[model samples]
Target: MTVALMWEARAVPGRAAELLAWTEERARELTERPLRRETFRAPQDRVLVITWWDAPYDADLPELPEPADDLTARPVHRWRFESLGSV
Candidate 1:
């Protein structure tokens, strides 16, 4: 089954640009190509990265590490989902 990894972070006030740059760097660290991936940002400094892979949900894969505490308002959040069916 294909799996989707969602990694999210919220930067400290006015640090969204820094957080986005940091996550962009992490995306380049992938060991293999994903089926598709996307990154999004919200007005409140929230950043989200979603990467789809051609592997099982539990498959070992590279993941983003926690960013500097000073750059984030809180710890990062991650979740995995398996594709059910396409619309």
Candidate 2:
């Protein structure tokens, strides 16, 4: 099965660029993992981080830096797909 992890969060009012840079770095790091596939989309005031990986593989979601309280974090939602047929 393929697993997808979705996370949404709001960046500080004027820190969109900073958030993008931070996520880029994290994505680069995540790519080093054999089963990791990650991408991001920013819409309105939220950032959508989507990651796909093998069912049993481990994934490290990027951790916010110090001053972590600056951005609001949302609960993560995960789904597992048995096949890619419907996607």
Candidate 3:
């Protein structure tokens, strides 16, 4: 089975760059490597990261942690999805 983890966050005001940098740094420092990883950004200072792992849906996997309070507008959002076969 394959699992895809999604982590999204919104930066505080003008701190989007700093928050994105922090997220990238933390993702790189993870001890376990994922099958695939990607980062994205959107309007309203939102950032999203998706990591794919070759493990069961409930398997333990390293995930990006929350940035400092001043860096984010609110708590981070995360989700997990089991991958279906690609078309």
Query: Which model scores highest in lDDT?
Result: 3
- Per-residue lDDT value at 68 in model 1: 97
lDDT of 3 by residue, 4-78 (tens): 999999999889899899999999999999999999999999999999999999998999988999999999999
lDDT-sorted candidate list, best first: 3, 1, 2
TM-score of each: 0.94, 0.57, 0.97
Model 3 Cα RMSD, Å? Answer: 0.6
Per TM-score, the best of the predicted structures is 3
lDDT of 2 by residue, 16-86 (tens): 66766665666566533424455565664455556655654354533323225564443333443333634
Candidates sorted on TM-score, descending: 3, 1, 2
- Candidate 3, residue 84: CA error in Å? 0.3
Determine which window of 10 residues in candidate 3 has minimal summed lDDT.
59-68
Query: What is the alpha-carbon RMSD of candidate 1 to the true structure?
Result: 0.9
